[model samples]
Target chain A: MTQTIIWTVAILTVLGLLLALILFWVARRFRVEEDPRIDEVEKAMPGANCGGCGFAGCRAFADAAVKAPNLDNQYCPVGGDEVMQKVASILGLTVEKKAPQVAVVRCNGSCTARPRTNEYDGVRSCRVKAALYSGDTACSYGCVGCGDCVEACRFGALSMDPETGLPVVDEAKCTACGACAKACPKHIIELRNKGPRGMREFVSCVNRDKGPVARKACANACIGCGLCARTCQHGAITVTDNVSYIDFTKCKLCRECEAVCPSGAIHGVNFPKELDKEAVKKRIADRKAKAAAEAKKEVPNG
Target chain B: MGKLTFSMGGIHPHDSKFARERAIEQLPLPPVVYVSMAQHLGAPAKPVVAVGDRVKVGQVIAEPGGFISAFIHSPASGTVKSVAPRKDLAGNPVVHVEIAVEGDEWEPSIDRSKQLVTAIPDDKAAILDRIKACGIVGLGGATFPTHVKLSPPPGKVAECLIINGSECEPYLTSDYRIMLESPKEIVVGAAIMQKVLGGCRCVIGIEENKPEAIRSMRAAVAELGYPGIAVQTLKKRYPQGGEKQLIDAVMRRQVGSGGLPIDVGAVVQNVGTALAVYDAVQKNMPLITNVLTVTGDRIPGNLQHNYRFRIGVPLSFVVEQAGGIPDTAAKIVSGGPMMGKAVSNLDATTVKGTSAVLYLSEAATRRRPETACIRCGHCADSCPMGLEPFLLNRLYKAADLEALEKHAAQDCIECGCCLYSCPAGVPLLDNIRQAKGQVMGVIRARAAAAKAAAEAAKK
Candidate 1:
């Protein structure tokens, strides 16, 4: 028994050593000389694999970054400027700081604003619903409200608001990954630069029907009356396809377009709401006081 | 003898033919008709008449816009009220010409005589032109322009003219009623199509369950003595009336994937389309009216009817004529239950392809909760195209377009057989249909890119 055990041990040890040597030689022969910076850059990434940088994954972006001469156009959107700064430091390169973006639904056709003309009873998927027909409302180009974007969101940044029957985007959690924009069948969601103090102005309507027809469909539908375009001194607003679009790059955010919009379709987000309420109340009180003074003077004259 | 069916996969659903015994009735002229610009597969027609213009029945109100589109004629003599966007049966807004009916005078060119004109013109071009001018389409729910189908692409020869009398979709009896009531007209239409195809052998394929239609068609063929024309009985199965399945059943020919029926030397037309062709070729009539069945199992027997209705009549009017929608109805379909789309808006008017208005009760239309797939292969077994629907569903959920293309998701006919046969109650066809659309778009884009590259290289 001792002889058998000794033979087995000796044979196994010899085989293991031989295989280990072969593996070591093979590894050396097939070694692909990759830049050591790739690992460091990948480690700096958020590892979200969100494809927000137009690459398949974090590793792919890191590979491209390490190989490229300069990091002019490449940046990790999920990790934002901090992670990108870390990556740039490791690569000893500079990246242009890009303004952070968040997805905003361009449609404001709430259930009350755009009444449902029909009821859909098919698959409750926005893609399927949009492919079959327009939304339940008369406006053919509006949010379908089927929660496809909610389903597409990986970060749980979207939810269907029961009161409005429209998708509500949670700006805090939104990475501007553009998954919702890609998932929306109507192309109603867009990635806009998150402005200073998260205050921004945009047209909340996408209806492209002629003025009267669009107004007939939705109360808040933009009629492309050119009022907003004319009001913008910065030439930021342009009407195309009977819908007004505001170019964020040129917008001064003066809120002139919002005041001049006839349909009230232009909306400003993250602004103080109490100021408008106070201004309206002050105007009403001034009118009432003026009327009372005029009545007293007329009674004395009679 | 072995049962006759398509070679691969099929399912046997409950017929639910509640209106089988109902006789065809004629619906009165609607007060106002909303004629859609898009009644066929290709580009929508362009309006030829403006608002306030007077039009007679069968007058061309909208002209065909492309090579594969059909003309849209006025269904009733009326004055055009407006040409604007209106809701279609699926609630999609389509350009429609709303006309207010004043009278029922038809165009003078149409032959209104009761006599049957059996003599077919040998001049194929004239026949095709007349068919095009008459706006006759398939009327089998596809509404493919008949003229385009009759003329196959160059280098392809039509071997068999198959008349589809298989109304396999449950609760639809319009085709059956047409076969039983006007068999002679249908046969003559088949002969005319055969002549157009240069004397191709014609076979009328009817389901065995529709024995009355089979007997009538066979008797009509025998009495008429139309050479090279015969009637064949098909086993009852869902989607048997599909062009590919009918071709396979009648001539044992399989249409290749992404290929037309002409590729397999076959030209398939519906029985309703055959009658329309007869009207267009022999009687000089444009397609203005279509027969449709309004049926619900919950409805009283006397209320169920197969109505010969003019195109552009609101579905609400038809439902009212059929004694109103029952309270038990939870869903209303524009066609049969299996493949028909749910009617979302009653104001949306009927088009040329409207065959049956089916109402499903709450119990019948209730969807069961989806469970995990046990890999029973039922979806594959029931797919007429022999496609793996469950696998396609998975790939669709994964958003893997490359794998979807490889699995031939574009070949799905959207027959709903997989959904019907799924024991797990999985919505296989619903997901596959969406995937198919996406895959088709990708394939078209790729083809366009290749063509552009080839052109650039040549330049």
Candidate 2:
């Protein structure tokens, strides 16, 4: 028992000493200068090195911050104001509190609005179909069922409603990364202010064709006829080349423009309380009535 | 045959060179031609001529807008129908000068004679000036001004000049036909490019697919007894014709990411550029016409009709001449399958950079449903630029801009190699491209921010 105990102790002593030496040498050899600022700057970072700021990652940003004088335009999309405050505190510099952005799909041409006019048998890819022709549906401005956008969204923010052949943005997962926007050839996706109540207003239709041509193509295309602009109390909308652009800065989320659109082309979102609920309900009813009238026109008289 | 090329990743799609051995034939003037001003890279050349102006063949219609831009010329003796906008393959409405071609006429200085001149020129400046004045650019679709290519930036010595005879893009045999028929002129052009590059040792690289071209070019190189001009046969691969790949294949040097061929002590010029140099210097002819290949799978007898049309010939009209779109053909692309873009508008015309009009069946273009990127490494295996496309694609998805920038996403040549080789059929470039743009914007913004900071510090 004595021999066994001594042997065990001796082996333990040697192993322990070797480990201690290794740790000591490793600590010395591979030790980075440990810029005290790196950790501070890192803590201040949003931790999502999603190259929106153009550096390699949070670590790289920290390195750049310590090396360079300021983080003027390096505001993190993920970190936003809170993280920027942390970073500014760490670096003892002033930071801009910029408005955060979220992605909004501009096209609302759902199944009822933009019905499929033809069937396609090839690849189920928006990119492929987009490359091949305008679309199987009569609405050239509408989403072609293939989910290039879904594939493009890294944050799992976009999911295609298989029935509607369109994408739905899950605001929680979305980072306003703009991947889907670039992936979409139709430019039907835009980034807008998330607004105070997680609500936002946007002209969902990106179709720039004239009012008449747009109506012919898609029932809900924004004709850029400037009706939305005239109706806005805050002058939030501008019409150029027959396309209505909502200036998010001036928009008050009143949903007034949605009421005045002849083609129901204007859209409002995240309204204050029950504001414009009646307008949307009436618009939906009128659209159903118009659809019924068209259906009736197609049917033979008894 | 020397070792197969040194490019990191490349694929061998079937080289349906339907027009491989087809003789170069002149395309008779169409009723109307729509020439786009924004043909080459860089800022689009501002139009110098307006609508309804009478233009002779080879007249300068547009001048270079910037250092990288190429000059535009009248394709044929014609009156400008309209200086209007026309849709391109990408559906971008580019400013186009529509020309209603009149009867065939030759430029005053252009030697209409089919005379072969073999005398090697001595003055590099004169040769380069002729090429520059003639507005001859790279003919293999890059359309980089030949003079600019010959004029390397100072302190960067070109060690070896690569004469790219690869003509590797499938279905386009304009270069191959040029090689087979006008072998001497081609040699003279390469020699001129070599001379203009300050007498760098020249190596004419050809893909082994064209054995006859190899044999003919090898014989010509030897017969001329040129000191440095050696014909090297490379393994057949698509995009072997790319400048970086061609440089790597010939010079055995990997071009640094975001670096050009000249950065590696080499200058790679395409075969068509060589011929254009010859025309500009030897014949004093301005660049107005190019031999375009009108071919597809259903094209009868593998019909390789090589027509010399002036830039801006409507692709729809060109397709009609080659017996219109086949009833079975579903998609029309501008260029080869690998690098080509689908033309949404058939009314779009052949620009200076327009190479081949590829017709892919619906079956050829359909994407298999995209599964999660299996990390197959096939994209890496095929990336000619040796980029980690899978990682880059993932980073792009996450919008991890910094990781993407560090990964050198800016170095991506956007050659569609990664997208083509992706087993998931994931639009790898579409994702990476967005990230790349964002990262670049960040870099630019950072640089500007740093400059401002420095300026403030100075103050």
Superposition error at A266 for model 2 (Å): 4.0
Candidate 2 lDDT, B251-292, residue by residue in tens? 778888667889999988877788878887888778777777
Query: DockQ for each of the predicted structures, in order?
Result: 0.43, 0.09
User: What are the per-residue Cα lDDT tens digits for candidate 1 across B1-459?
Assistant: 344778889877877778878888999987999999998999899999999999999999999999989998999998999999887876667899999999898899899896988888988999999999999999888999999999998999999999999899888899999999999999999999999998999989988888999899999999998899989888999899999999998888899999999999999999999999999999988999999998866767867899999999999999998888887788888998888888878888999999988888888887777888999999999899989999999999998999999999999999999988888988788899899999999999999999999999999
lDDT of each: 0.89, 0.78
Off by over 4 Å in 1: A1-21, A66-75, A81-95, A111-122, A136-139, A209-234, A239-242, A256-264, A273-302, B1-3
